[model samples]
Target: MNDDPRRIHCDRHGAQRPAFVCGHLVSGVGLGFVEPEGPQDEDASDEQAAWCDRCETARLAGGGWTAQSEAAAGITLVCAVCFEASRARNTHWMEGVARGWRHTDAR
Candidate 1:
């Protein structure tokens, strides 16, 4: 109900901030959109990736880190930790919005 940008939730918890892992599976995942360039202008782009605060820690834990599976939706950056936990309690991650995001610029 609140407007906390990072306030993502699990189907079971109602409202929760689950730990996540952002994978750079594809080179640039967060780019929003791109603009064409003129004869003398360079292309312009915008980033829409959700950068996580815990990514720094996960980045430091580099050894155990691995790329997520390639799901039908798109690249899965979030790890199964929270996903599995929610499943254990009979719920899904992102409250059934587990479908991954498609960065427009990735096209």
Candidate 2:
């Protein structure tokens, strides 16, 4: 019943989990959202597609990364290949968050 948005339960232990980002989950850590590539069945507009910030590639074929956020509440489809690449680039940021959390817990 902990009313904290930053805290989540730890699956490994019954301890109050600190707010930390997993690099394996999404690109980098921090509080940013990630939309992994998947499939799309319905007709979507241009804005619904996920654009690669690195390669500037746009997914126009099938399912791709789809994510919704406060700024972009609609579905954003991204290509699988590009999404994976982006994830790799974001791993460093995730590691940083993990390190910061560990340091804070040690105090």
Candidate 3:
């Protein structure tokens, strides 16, 4: 009865024999097991950016990338990889909004 949250022990037939903790299946084979990695540091520069819901990598808005809409309703800043992935996942949309810009209408 292991108490670890990341570790998983399965049976010989890959039937998910049920262990002490929840597990994420790695390969389709039943001869191996895997432990999930820890969360990334939120303050890290690489971590600061979100994985483009479309490309699955960090989005660089100025680096030949564009903003796209997500099926979840709202915009998801994404890269080329994620853009394609998001399209495949059917979880994203395309729309534009102002970011980091100030409006003089308030004055």
> Cα-based RMSD of the predictions, in order?
18.5, 13.5, 19.7
Q: For model 3, state the Cα shift of residue 10 in Å.
A: 34
**Per-residue alpha-carbon lDDT of model 1 for 5-77, expressed as tens digits?**
5555445455544442233322333321111234422442221222222343443356422452212114232
lDDT of 2 at 84: 46
Clash count of each predicted structure: 2, 11, 11
Compare candidates 1 and 3 on lDDT and give the better one.
Answer: 1
Could you estimate the TM-score for every candidate? 0.23, 0.23, 0.17
Off by over 4 Å in 2: 1-68, 73-75, 93-107
lDDT string for model 3 (1-107, tens) is 74643333333322221221101111112212211235644652331122222332212233422354222212323333433333333322221112233435866
In the range 1-107, model 2's lDDT, one tens digit per residue, is: 65764344444433342422223333432233334356544663322122222211222221333342212332222333434444546545656477573335555
In model 1, state the lDDT of residue 67.
55
Native RMSD of candidate 2 (Å):
13.5
Cα lDDT listed for each candidate: 0.34, 0.36, 0.28
* Deviation of model 3 at 83, angstroms: 0.8
Q: In model 2, how large is the Cα lDDT of residue 3?
A: 75
In model 3, state the lDDT of residue 99.
25
Model 1 lDDT, full chain set: 0.34
